[model samples]
Target chain A: MTTSFEDFAAGQVTPLLRYATVLTGDPHLAQDVVQECLLRAQQRWARIGGLDAPGAYLKRMVTNEFLSWRRRFKVHSTLTGIDPPTPDPAGRYDERDAMLRRIARLPRKQKAAVVLRFYEGYDDAEIAAVLGCTQGTVRSHISRALSTLRAADRVKEAL
Target chain B: MNTEDLIRDALRRQADLAPPPGPVLAALHRPRRRRKPLYLVLATAGTAAVVAIAATTFSRPTADAPPAGSNRPPFSTVTGSPSPTGVPSGKLVSLEYAPTWLPDGFVEWRRSLFDHGWQRTWRQAPPDHSPSAPALTFEITRGSIGSLLESADEPANRTTVNGAPGVYTDDGLRWQVADKLVLTVNLDNVPDARGTIRRIAESVRPDRRQIRVPVSFGGSTRFTVSANSRDDWTASTDVSYRDGRYMAMLHSVAHVGSSPRTVTALGREASYEEAGGGVLTIPLAPDRFLSVGGLGLSGFQQPVPVETLTEVAALVEVDLGVDLSWLGV
Candidate 1:
């Protein structure tokens, strides 16, 4: 028997929304991303309904959306001669929160590679699949992302 | 100091924010609105059904499962028994690709998405050795619509479609249009059985006029377009609108490698020339409309008249949230 889209979505939307929020940093955009992801998933409920891990597919979509948004932002930013705005300074927040925010502020690929690697605990191969790049590229993204993070950390410490 | 520690903390924070109760289930079953496009229905049906099955088998707990360790939840659980939600299962399908039907003069082509599954990628048909020939392209992707399009190498533009924000970009080499509706076609996979897929892909084009959607939504709209038999490709849209400003959030798919029957059953088939080869009207205002043709096209040009359309008109309501005046063109 086929499952109802509403029931399946009811159980999964929250976690997926959470995933989208982390990827996009903006709550509204996150909601938009989740909405788009879930909406699309709803259309294909009958087919994808049989997948081994449906959340993996949705998560990939969320990541792709976040990547797309970042690319668009970069294009617009380039046209306006604006680099991504500097991230706000870490206030009384914990070091981990501060570090994660700093990581979030990196270039799209780099940030995703880092998040998929360290935070999501995905190995290099897994990160490669999610990011749709060669494992070497994934490693490179992680390397660059971490270097940027570590550099920022040192700078923060000096400040 | 390991990177995983930092990443996990952030991921946990992200997981904490969930969709509000009650609305979550409805949001998944259908778009948050009433009206819908065929493509949305196919894609959503595919996704929702897949998730439900996965949840049943994969979410089962195993006592001896691996520890949660540095990760969290559902560690190495044994697969469970089927808890079918009872939605009718459509035919298991495959998409096809072929290089010959491409008109003669197109410069280059590449396939972005292809696999033996319900989804297929979109690309333009090749030009017939004519410089003025229009580009042809199609896309069949299943994730973030924004991400699927923006990741391409071509230059894209950010603009609003009928007031909804989106990106528009293309280059002469190959073209891609990704948003709620994606367009682009590849030449390598069409089988003899998939001619209908090619025909549908050839039919997609950009539209000039704007079609209005008449629906109320703080909900969602799920739309889909698929390629089926040699002479048939079907497109569908479904919306689940809740009370809100956005009529319905839209999602669409253009399948190029499946049979018409398969496409229709899956909800990915679309009719681009239904209302003439320019605009495929949704028949529901403030509800949905799919426009194909004009300045909005990329790749080898077929008839792409707004295949998956949606609208979110701004509403001016009083303190009681009752309608005062509807604001939108």
Candidate 2:
């Protein structure tokens, strides 16, 4: 069945924006990236809509836009200072917020691989396809990212 | 309590940051700026002139002309010194001719559009990490075709293309197809080179078209964009100010090499350096970077401040999802 661009975009934009948000760590930039991708997709929706998995295709587009958005503009979320999460009443560190900040600081590819794996639940093959790299490269990216996060965890434990 | 579980939970929480899609959808519905009419005017003028020349040269009656549709030599060759033709004055904005036929397994793989001409290449297979791979190239230029023929190492074998005089040499076939138009076909490592070159040259037809680049700039109106190149995986553009005071180049290829320093631009860490002028390399993807180099100069030709380059980098708008397949050869 041939789906119109409007219908496809209307149905897919939310999920795409979510994925982009996690990948970019910036909701506003995520919106901009998703909108830009959707506009481009609309420009050639006649061909994209005929694909067997237009949603997946658009997801890949969102992934690529997130990957490249930094080069096009200054990405504030990644570099701008973030206030530390408020300590719980018990005075324990907010591990989740700390981890999110660390993940945001990871290199773009490593962050993308980790998000695709943990957040998107993508296997190495699928992540490789989206990242335009070999499965071995994807594994390397995820491994390096986990190492960085783990090192931070050990420092917290020692302190 | 494990790191994997912690990461997942954190990511889910971050996903909630995604805003509603209403604003984005509304932005998409807004009208876009129309492309300049200069492109249309140039395309129409170039096409009409080429069509007129092609029709006149090909339709001329000759006693020795082969019967219609039969596979025979359409024009005879004569030995003579090719005359120097006047160079065309205007910039070439559209491709005016394309090969109507190619060898059985050939597929276009690269294309470059410059101010004075465009070149396209076709290969039997992907270059596949081999720069020396065999291919065929078709080029049309309004620049000096005589210079190309003059630079040939071997003597030229004079020939005729559709009744107009041309030259055939070891490198390729060259024909002054019109007053300002020159067509050249280069065959490399192909079998039956002589026959292939002749057939390909004869099969040329008018195909006027322009490439819609994936990147656009909403910067100053004084800057005019020109000279675009694209291949299988990358594209680039050159923009220069009218008075030649400043120029900026944008490239899609990543700058993986190390730089001496980094500076904040567009709120991101960008590798900065000053070789000839200021160059900024911003990470676009793990494998790709948008390289914006500024050639700004003061009245005394001194390099301008790096801030000007930063501003130029900010003005670039990239549509990462645009299907660039059309820009390929």
- Give DockQ for candidates 1 onward, in order: 0.10, 0.15
Question: How many angstroms is residue B50 displaced in model 2 relative to the true structure, after the best TM-score fit?
Answer: 68
User: Candidate 2: which stretches are off by over 4 Å?
Assistant: A72-74, A78-80, A90-93, B32-329
lDDT score at residue A151, model 1, on the 0-100 scale? 83
Quick one: best DockQ, which candidate?
2
lDDT of 2 by residue, A44-132 (tens): 98899999988888888887766764533223332112222245574323666668868877888899999999988999999998899
**iRMS of each prediction in angstroms?**
17.2, 23.3
Tens-place lDDT per residue, model 2, B1-329, is 88898999889867754544433443454343122100000000000000000001122222232345965322211111122122211112345788888888776644555434566767665332121245577877653345335544555476777765567755467777777677778776554687889889999887755333334343221111111224214333434333322223223333321222577655556676443233455554343345454322111123334465555555454323223443323
Report the lDDT tens digits of candidate 1 across residue range A87-135: 3376322454455456656888887787676556688888888889999
B328 in model 2: Cα distance from truth in Å? 40
TM-score against native, each model? 0.36, 0.38
lDDT of each: 0.36, 0.53
DockQ-based class of model 1: incorrect
